[model samples]
Target: MRMVQKPSSVVLASLKPSTYTNRTPRAGTLPAHRLAGVSKPDAPYSSRRAPRCGLVGRTFSPFTIVLLVILGGVVATAAQEDERATVEPTLARRAATLILARCAVCHTTDLIVQQRLPEDRWTATVEKMVHWGADLTKDEAAVLLQYLTARYHPGAPDHLPSIENELAMTEPLRGQTTATDGPLTGLAARGAGLYAHNCQACHGEGAVGGVGPKLARNTILKNDGVFWETVLHGRGPMPAWGSVLSHQDIADIHAWLATR
Candidate 1:
């Protein structure tokens, strides 16, 4: 029982290595499972995935780059058109100041914009208005006339007939007393357009007075001289048009008002 039992030589030899090789893994080498293309239990293939293919760290194809360029171009062009569409504040302010001070008293901007008169006509019109009690001084009139002539010259295809020319042409008709007696219907019809342009703002769309007294049933209609005087020289808040309107224009407007 005290004697030690020696292992058999075959058993001892079987336990010993033939070449005594030390197999410590080298640094920067994958684990056995990973080297064999097998996922490790602790670190899975799905969790330690290859770098994903996406916009990040990825090169764009030529077609993709072209699409991006075209989209950018479209955005830039739209931005430029938006800029052009807007009106300049300075220009708008200048026009508004002049128009409101001198022209807006008698009529809306619509009336002024609708007429595309020549330089001479615009000058004459502005001068006439000043004479008839417009608040403008000579310098202001010049500025306003310049603006009007520049923005609304008669060179435009849609420019309206000159007031002077229209009046000069209608003078013969005004002299004919029989023109009024034969049938006021025709005269009233023509006067409708003129009334809408000139008198509608104050006398109203139907001559029922907004800023001015009602003209529909006014007794002043019976007296031609008083009616003409009231219109040409203005009454109270009414602006005078003695220089602006011709006798024929006034007569026609009166005829239209009489109908109303």
Candidate 2:
């Protein structure tokens, strides 16, 4: 029979589960089982190894953590861009409507559409108009300002459906007046342009009438109060211009139409 040596007290003490559980093994030190020349049983998985499926037990390098953060930011920015694209067109349409309904009342659309101004200048212009009696709520003014800056910025293309073309088409008809009539001057001249822009569309060239009733020789022009009331408050099918045209603007238009 082969003789076996008794295990030392130190080796037996180190073999206890409490020894391994209570303290980490020193570097270069072997487990008690390895030192004793006994093989450890194979575990299904090692607790020291990183988990394959989840973030648990994982240790990322500094570079990897930074890269993950960058990716998350990229995703968030892309989502915001998509949302802005969806909302921009609707806001643009609303802005266009406000411009037509409000700005076009006093001056022709061409006056507003022709200029390419920067944001600060546009803001100043809009504010000036408000100060001068434009009827716009704070919200409406803000929306209009945003639209003007975006669509009429210095870098933007010129507005289309050319004002020059419209002017050319109406100029000849506008120039023709009765042999007894004198040349237009002052507020009357200004009103000619306003009438052409605002009234000619429905009232026909020189307010001769088409969709709207004839105003060329309409007796309504004889009474200032009736004319102001009808134009500002609207008639049967006409929309009110009270919120758009200032008193001075309506007066100028009246001065010009009286000639027609």
Candidate 3:
């Protein structure tokens, strides 16, 4: 207790001034990296670890760059496919054929479809056609009215479902009526059915006219069998009705049309 111990230089640093004048070493000094806060490895160690850290700091990760490139290519291909897959929205040309031939003759399709009345109003319209000597069978009348009311009426979209939607509702109706139903004797009646399906567009109820010449004027009366054949086979923009309808169906239709 009586003898006092002298402090070592390492411990006596506190006795030195807090701020001292620069005393630069002549040969070399302790590492400047350590003074700035970095610590060098103790002994022999691989130097590659520091370089790897620098690479990560200096650039985008290679994996991230590759992912961005792949995503960009996928987005480009999707855009191209969308451009090529444009869809159309309108009544199919085939659907218009009958309406154009049969209904447009008396009044414009614009007028006909625009009327947009109830079921009773539609029945009255068909009945009026009957009063005018239009030869439509009961079934033909129903089909014609149904077709018109479905496509043209304001209430149609609600009451009458489209064929596509009907896949869940009812079996799709077929165009193939029994051939035995065909008869030259009943040709006029059969033709009425065909007319509702095919001729209503331009011919109207009695083959009047909107876009084409009227049948009531006997334009059809003067046509020869060959002429009929040519028209049926589509000489031009008229389209080949022969291909769309069966032979017996064609015969019955021809017979009914002749009566009209």
The model with the greatest TM-score is 1
lDDT tens digits, residue span 158-211, model 1 = 443333332233333334321234333336776788777666766787888887
Best by lDDT: 2
Cα lDDT tens digits, model 3, 76-184, are 3343233212211121222333343444345434555445454567779888986775555554455556445434333222233333232223323443433234343
| TM, every model | 0.34, 0.33, 0.30
Look at candidate 3 and tell me the lDDT of residue 231: 44
How many clashes would you count in candidate 3?
17
> Which is the winner by TM-score between candidate 1 and candidate 2?
1
Q: Judged by lDDT against the true structure, how good is candidate 1?
A: 0.52
Per-residue C-alpha lDDT of model 2 across residues 106-223, encoded as one tens digit per residue: 6656677777666778989999998986766777787677656544544333333432243233223332212213332338777887777567767889889987889887998898
Q: Per-residue lDDT for 136 in model 2?
A: 67
Comparison by lDDT, 1 against 3, better one: 1
Residue 163 accuracy (lDDT) in model 3: 30
Arranged by TM-score with the best first, the candidates are 1, 2, 3
TM-score for model 1? Answer: 0.34
